[model samples]
Target: MAASDNTPATSGLHQQAVDLLHALTGRADAHFHPGQFEAIEALVENSRRALVVQRTGWGKSAVYFIASLLLRARGRGPTLIVSPLLALMRDQVAAASRAGVCAASISSANATEWSQVLGQLDRDEVDVLLISPERLNNARFREEQLPQLVNRMGLLVVDEAHCISDWGHDFRPDYRRIKDLIRQLPPTVPVLATTATANQRVVHDVQEQLGVGLVESGREPVMTLRGPLARASLRLGVLRLPSNTVRLAWLLEHLGSLEGSGIVYALTISAAEDTAHALREAGYNVEAYTGRTDPADRERLESALKDNQVKALVATSALGMGFDKPDLGFVVHMGAPSSPVAYYQQVGRAGRATERADVLLLPGMEDREIWEYFATASMPTEAKARAVLRELGEAQAPLSVGALEARVDIKRSPLNMLLRVLAVEGAVEQVQGGWQVTGAAWHYDAPRYQRIHQARINEQNAMLDYENKSTCRMQMLVEQLDDPQAAPCGRCDNCAGAWYPTHVSQQAAENATATLKRVGVEIDPRAQWPVGLQRLGVPLKGTIAPGERAAAGRAVARLTDLGWGNRLREIFHTDAQGAPVDQPVDQELGRACVEVLAQWAHDGWSGAGRPAGIVSMPSVHRPQLVQSLAMGLAGAGRLPYLGELALAPGHPGGAGGNGAYQLASVWQKFQITPQLQTALDNMNGAPVLLVDDLVDSRWSLTVAARELRLAGAAAVLPFVLASRG
Candidate 1:
C-alpha cells in the first residue's frame, strides 16, 4: 500500500488561532511533545501526501486535524473527515464546534439529525463534516440529494486510515471505497489521511486507497511518547482459567477489591451477559455492550461508564473506537482477543492520559480457542468487481441493512457489511427503502483482487512468523513496516520474556495441525450412523422418527471418486507390525475430515477429561461424535467410555481398554459462528459441539450435518461424549 501523488497538503494555509487551539487540545492531539510538533509542522507545510509513522502517544491527530482546519481556513471548502469510530465523530465534532467551526457528524447516535445537517449543508451552513463509513452508506444519506451535497464539499480527511488496508491490523471492508469516494469528490479537494499505526505496505495501501499526496515524516510516535514509553507501570496480569465460571469468579472478586471504573472484554454476547449477571449478583453495577444491545440501553451504558455510575463494563470490541474515559484503573479481557490491534484498542480503553492501569488478560482454554478461531476462520477475498456490479444491478431503491438482510439469506450483520462494501465501491446506490443499482458492473477481477489480497496475506503471515523470530516482537513489527529500529522495545512481552519463543512455536504447531491441513484426519461424509435412521442401506431423505436405535456414524460416501474409504481404512488400520498405518491421507475430503479431528483435540477439548454419561447421538451426524471423543481424549488424557461399550473382543481399543471407552448413547448438538468455526478448524476441523441440547430422536443432527457438509466439510459426525439422560 502506497500513497498516491494526489494527496492534499496545507503548505501555505494560515490557521485561525481558535481552530489551531481546538485541534491542539483535542484527544487526537493529546500528549504531543516538542519533536513531534516539528514533524507535524513539516507535514503541515508539505503539499504532498505525507506518511507520519508516529507512535501511539505522539499526537498523530494534530498532523491531520491541524492540516484539515488550516486547509479549510485557506479556503479549501468543507473537509470531509473519514473516521474509523462512530464515537470519535462526536469528540471531533465537539472539539470543532468549540472552535467555532460548524461541524456535524452522521452516526447511529444522531440518525435522524442527518437530514437537518444535510439541509444545512445544502444551505452552506457547515464547514467540516465528520462521519463513519457506516453513516455514509445510510440509504437516506447516499441518495441523489446527498451525493450532490458531497459534490459541493471540498477536502477529504481519512482518520484511522489503516482500516482501508487489508494488511492493516484492523481491517474494515466499509473503508475500502473511501478512495473511490474521494475520487468522486470535487476533484480539487485534497485528501488528508491519518492513522496511529501502519506498516510500510499498509502506508502504501492507504495512499493508494485514498489517493493521498506524498509527504513522509520519518518519526515514530509510540517511541517518542513521554517516559517509559510502553506504559510499563501498568500491572500486566495473566490469569489462566479452566472454565468460564471460574474466570467469572476471579473477575467478580477483583471487581469487588478494585472498586473502581474498569472494563471487561468478553468474546461473545452470552459471555458478556453471564459475566454481567454474575457481577450484578455480587452487588456490582455493570452492563454489557454489544451490537445486539438496544440503542437506548447502549447509550445508558456509555453514560454509566462515563459518569462512573457503573463500576465496571462487560463489553465486546464495540466498547472500543472513540470511547474516552480517563479514569479507568483496569481493563480485563475475560476472553482472548485476536491480533494486537484489537488487544491494543481494547486495553487502550483504560489508561487514558497514561495513567497507572491494570491490564489483565484472563484467558481460558475456550477463550484462547475462540480468538484463534476468528483469526483462522476469516477468509479475505479479492475485490470482486462483479459482486459489486450485481448488487448495483439488482438494487432498485435505497436499501438499509435490514432490507438487504431480507433480500439475502445471509446473517444481517455480515450482509450489511458486504452491502457497505458495495456501497463504497459505488456498485449499489443507497436509497430509503432498498438499494438502487447505479448501473456499475463490479464483476470479479482476479488481478486487481490478487494485488490487495496478496499484500494482506503477506502482512499477516509476517506477524504470525514474528513469534519464531529471535528479534524483539516490537522490533519485528516495526521492521516489517519498514521502520528498522536498532534497539529492542524493552517494555513489550517479548522483552520481558512474557511471550517466550517456545510458547509461540508450541501454539503455532498446535494451530497448524488443528487447522484444515492435508496431513490431518479426513471426515467421511458418507459414514452413516445406524442409531436414529430407519435402515442402514436407505439414504436419509425426509427425517428420522423417534425411538430409533444404533449409534451415530459419519459417512464419507460422497467422495467415491476420491476413494475416501481407502484413506479411512489406511487411517484406521494398523500395519503388519501392529502400529498405526503410516501412509498419508491424500484425498481432499479425507484430509479435511482428519483436520476436523485435529481441531477437536486442540479447541474442543474441555480439559475435564471425557464427560461421564450414557453418550447418545442422532444417527445422521456421526462425525460430531468422533469430535467429542477426540476432545475427551485430549482434555482428560484418556477416553471416558472405556468401560461402557459392549464391543467385539478384538475391537481396536476394546482388547485392552474397558467398556467405559465407548460413549453411552447421547445426542450431540451444535451451533456455529465464524469464530467458533475457526476454533474448530484450529482444533483439527472439529466443529463446535454441544452435548446437552441434544434430545433423543431429533432431526437437528440431520440438519446440522447437511449444513456442515454444505460448508465444505467432508463430514459431520455427532457422537455423544457424555449423557445426562
Candidate 2:
C-alpha cells in the first residue's frame, strides 16, 4: 500500500476517515486541519511512519484516532498509543468513546482494570489501547503481553513524542524504549509520533528514532508534516514585578477580571501551593495542582477548570502537555519557564477554541536559580553513573532501589532515572526482584551530555530573552521552537499596547504582604532509618524508637516558601569563598522565628509542656547563626540556654547524598559535652529545643536529638530556621 495508490479502496478509506472525523467532533461541517487528513492518509492507506509537528490545538489526536479506526476496519489489530500523562490518557479514552472507538488504558493508577483490559485485548474488543511508556518495560507486560500486542498492533501512536528525544524539554528515560518498540512492531504497522514542542534539533532526533528498523526494512523515510506554530488567539505579555509579594498582589487585584477560567503556572510546588493559597484567600476559586497533588484530585481539578467552575488552577509543570480545555481564558506564569519552547507549550493551552485569550509571564528573580537546580538534578553525572554500575556489578542478587540508595549515594528519584538510562543503554536490567547488571559495556558519553547541558543553558538564556525582549513574545517562542513561518503575532502586548492592568491596590498589597510574612512549616521527623544502613557501617535499621525519636519539629519556613523563603535564602546564602556566611539572626527573622515558636507552643508540642531550655546543634558552617537563633529564642522565652553540642573531630561536614549516606555522615558526629551535660542536668529532665540553621535530610536533627535524649533530656524538640525539601 503506497500513499499514491489512490485506488477505490483508498478513496473509500478516506471517506470513512472523513465521516469518523465528523463523528469525533459531532460537527457535520467539521473538516481536517491542513496536515490532519494527509497524516491520516499516510498512516491508514500507506501505513507510513509520520511525524506531525503541529501546534497544541492542531488536532493531532484526530489524525491518530481516525487512522486507528481505518486500520481496524481493514481487519488490522488494535491501535497502541503510548501517552505520557494519565490526564492525557483519560481525555483520549473519553474522546475515543465519543467517536465510537473502544479504548482502554493500563497504568499504575488503574490496577483493577488490567485484567479487563487484557481480556478485551485478547478478544479483539478493544479498538485502541493507551499506555504510558514506562508500561512497556513492565515485567509482565514486556515478557508476556507486549510481544502479542506488537505482533497485532495495527497502529502505534506516540503522543508527546518530544519526550523521546534527549533534546526534548521534558525528556524521560522510559520514552527511549519506544525506539525498541518501534523496531519490534510489524513492518506493516503505521507509526505516528506527535508533539507540539519540538524544535529542529528535537524534530530531527525524533525523526531518526522513528526511522529505526524501517529503513533497514527498505521502508521509505518518515513523512514529516510540520505546520506554523503561531497561535493567533493567544495575547502574550511579560509583567516584571519587583518581588513575590507584589506579584501575588497583582494577581489579587487583576485575576478576577480575566476573561475566563485558566491556569496560573508556578515554577515549583511550594510556589504553586502558596500562590493558590493567596488566590483562594482573595476569594478566587482556585486550587494548586502539582506532582504532589493526588491523582484523583488532579482529575477533579482538571474537570473543575474545564467546566469553568474555578478561576484557575495554580499549577506546576504537572498540569502541562495534553491537558485539553479549548476555551481556557488565560495562562499566567508566576515565573518564566526555563525554556521558551516549554513556555509556549504551557501558554498554548489558552484560547484554543475561543476568539481570544491572555498569556502573561511574571518573571521572578529566583527563576534562574530554580532552573539551574533542576537542570543539574535531571542530568546524570559520569561519576554517579559509574557508581551505580559498580554497585550493581558487585551485588550477588538484584538490588531494590532502597538497597541501591544505601549502597549508592544517589536519592531514590534520581536513582530510578539512572537505572532507566542504564537499562536503555543495555548496562542494566530491571527484573522481578530489583535491578541487576546486564554485563553490557557502557561509555560515559561525556561530550553528548556536555552538549545537552550547554543546550539547556542556551534555552534558559532564550527564556530570559523572551522576558526582556520588546519584540513579539509569540514570535520569539515560535522561533525558539524552530518555526520557520514565525511572524509577529499582532495580538501580543508588545504589538498591541498592554491590555492588562498593572495596578495593585494598597489594601491588596498589604494583604499579600501579610500572607507572605506568615510562617511556620511543619517538619515531619524521619521515623525509620534507611534500609541497608548496616552495609554503610551504621547499625541503624527499622523505625527509631518513639522514645529516642525527636518529636515532630517546626521550621520557620521551607527553603522554597514564597515569603520567608526569600529571606532565609539570603541568610543561608554562600559567601564568595563558597561557605555559608556565619551571620547572626537578623531582627526580622528572629521575630518570625519567635512567632513560629509561639504558634507551635499554642498548637501543643506533641502534648508536652513548653520547651524548658534551648540547645544549639554544632554547625560546622553556620554555628554563629544557629547559636544566635537558639540564644535569642531562649532569652525571649525566659528559658535557660544549654551549651551547644560538640562536633567530633574529623567528622564529615558536607550535606547531600541519600538518606543512608547523609545519616552516616552525621551519625555519632555530635557529642554531648560535659558542660552541655551539666546544663541538661540542671534543666531537671525538661524538654529541650534543639536549634539548627537548616534541615536537609533530618539526619543531623535525628542524630543530635538521640544524643540529647540519651544525655538526660526528657524530650528533644527540633527547631530549624528552614527545611530544605
Candidate 3:
C-alpha cells in the first residue's frame, strides 16, 4: 500500500501514466481498472485526440487520469482536465490528493487558490490541473495567465464530452467551443475526452466538433447488462393531484409516511416553501431550497443533506445542479419537469449504487400549464447568439463588457448575459485580460442552422406524437427515444396497468372532441346530437339556453377590461355612489376573458380582429382569457386573493372606495385569508358577476366563489360554467 509499492512501469499506452505517477506521487502501483487500460491502449493505437464513453459508476475519470499520469511521468508536460461541474472537479482533485498526486483544481469556489496553483504550475511545481470550462473560458484569466499554462499541458482532457454535442441531453455552447482552444495547443500534445453516456449521434458530433479522431473502445454492440441490471435501480412512481393545495397536502403526507434523506423538486420557490411548511406542519423534518437562499446557507443545507441531518429537502432545480449524493434514497419530482431528459437525470441521481430508490412524479394540472408554456415560450435566436460569438473571434484579446456590447450591437446587460451563457457552453473564455473566442470547428453557418432547426422540428413533432399516442406508456417512451428494441418495460404506468392503452386512447379522443366542441360553440344538447348541427358554432357548454344569455352577456362585458373589446367601456359599471367603478368579475368568466386578452395583448389588440363587442371565440380562447383577466384584476389590486382591492378613481359606494375585496368574494362570496380579505375590502364598486364559459373541473369556480363571498359583496352568482359531461 506504500507509494513505492511494486506496480510495474508499463510500456506503450500506459507508459506516460506510470512515469507521471512515479514522478508525482512516487507510487509504483496506483490501481487502474482493465477498462481503463483498454481505453488507454485504444487511444494510443488510434489517435491522440480520442473519446472514451462509459456508464456513470464506471471509472471514466481514471482513464484520463492514468493518461495524464503517463504523460507527466515521461516529462511531456502538465495535464489539464476541463470538467463541466465544479464539484466533480473538486472531488477528482481530492481523490488525487488522497492518492498522493500533486493535483489542484481551478473553479469559482477557489479563485484565489487557483491563481496560487497556476503560479505553482508555472514554476514547474505542479503536475495535474483540474478546472471548469467557465474558468478556462475566461479571457482575462486566459490571456494574462492560461496561455502559458496550457502551453505546458502534455494533454487536454475534456470530461463529460457529451456536452460538446448539442444533441446531448445537456448541451453547453461553451463546450462546443473547446476545439478552437485545442487548435492553439502544441501539435504533439494529446487530447482525451470522456463521458458516461453518448448515443451514436453524440459520439459523431463530439468527434466532428472536437476535430479529433476518435478511439471508441467498449462500444458494445449489445447491452452488457441485461435481466435485473437492465431495470433501473430507481423505481418511478406517479401521484395525481386534484389541486395545488392538494399537491402540498399529499407531499406532506408522503414525507410523514416515508422518512429518509430525500429531495422534493417543486416547480416554483413559492411552492417549495409552502410545501416545506405543510410538511413541517405535518410534523416531519423538512427544509426548502431556492435561488433566493444565501450561498452559505445553501452549502450548509447540502452538507446537512449529506450528513443525513435533514430528513428531506424541498427545492427547485437550483438546489441540485452540481451537488452529488451517492447514497441518495430518492428524488421526488413534486411537479412535472419541463422535459424528459431533466426528469431522467434528476431521477438518476438516486440509486447511484444500484440500491433500491424511489422516483416519484406528483402530477398536477398546473404541470400541463408548465409544459404548454415551454412549448410556446420564445428562446433567444440561435443566430443572434452565434453571431455575437463570431464577433468575439475577431478580437485579438479579451474584450471588455462595454467594447463587446458595441461590437455585438446588443445592450450591455444582454451582451454580458450571453457571454456568461457562451462561457458555460465552452464557446468563449473570459480571463482577467479579455475575451477569447473558442470552438472554431463548430461554426455558425446555414448548415448548422438547418441541422438545429431540423432537430427542433423533430422535437415538436415528437411532442405531438406524445399527445396523440395510443400505445403503452413504456412503448411511447421507447418510441420517443427511437429505441424500438427496448424490451417491454414492465414497471411503467402502462405496464403496471395504471395507464391502459384503451383507456388513454378513449380519453384522448374524448378530450379532442371536447376541445373541438368548445371552440366551435354549440349552445344546445341537440347541437351536440349526431348530425344535429352541421359544424357547431362557437363552443357550447352543456346546453346554452335563452335564459343563460344574460349571464353570457354579463361575462362578455368584462372581455373589454381584459383587452378583448374595443369601443366598449374599458371600465365597466360604477359603485352605488355614482363614481366610476370596476368590480371583481366572476372567476370562471374572468379566467376565460383574461386568457383571450393575453393573446390580444401580445398581438396589440389587432390579432383578435379589433372587436368592439362579443366575437365568436374558440374554447381554447377561454382558458387563456381567464388567466389574463385574473392578471389584470390582480394588477389593479381588484382581484385580491387575500387583501381588498382599491376601487378605480372617482369610485363611489364607500368613503375611500368600497371595503377591500377578497378574490373569493368575487366568486364564492367568502374570505379565505387576511391578505385576500384586505383586497376584497378595498373595492368600492358594484359587484360584477363574472361568468365563465366552462368550469370543467369546478375547482377554479369553487375558489372564485369562496373569494367573492369573503369580500362581503352584495351578491355573487354563477353563469354557464360546466365541466365536460
**By TM-score, highest first, what's the ranking?**
2, 1, 3
lDDT of 1 by residue, 42-102 (tens): 4344433344554443455555566556666566656677787766776566666654578
lDDT of each: 0.50, 0.89, 0.52
Q: Please give the TM-score that candidate 1 achieves against the real structure.
A: 0.58
lDDT of 2 by residue, 285-389 (tens): 899999999999999999999998999999999999879999999999998889998898899999889889999989888898899999999999989999999
Worst 10 residues of 2 by lDDT: 1-10
lDDT of 2: 0.89
- Each prediction's TM-score versus the true structure: 0.58, 0.97, 0.57
Model 1 Cα RMSD, Å? 14.7
**Candidate 3 or 1, higher TM-score:** 1
lDDT of 3 by residue, 1-725 (tens): 12333344566555665554444344566554335555565443442566665444445665666666555666777778888875566557765665456788777878778768867887877767887776655656667767886677777888877778766656666675577677677656677787654556777787775553222433312111101112245555555644444445445445544535878888666557656765675576779888777766877888788788888888887764356676777777766665453455456566665456666676645554455554333233566677777777877777766445435435344455567666665577676665777765443355764675566556545533433444443344334333425455566554564421111233333432332222111112111111111122212233423222211112232211111211123233245786554343455444554554444335543221222211111122344433344345445333332222222343222111001111111222222455534444565422334334443323333334434544454333333322221
In model 3, where is the ten-residue run with the lowest total lDDT?
655-664
Question: Which one wins on lDDT?
Answer: 2
Number of backbone collisions per candidate: 96, 0, 101
Q: Whose lDDT is higher: candidate 1's or candidate 2's?
A: 2
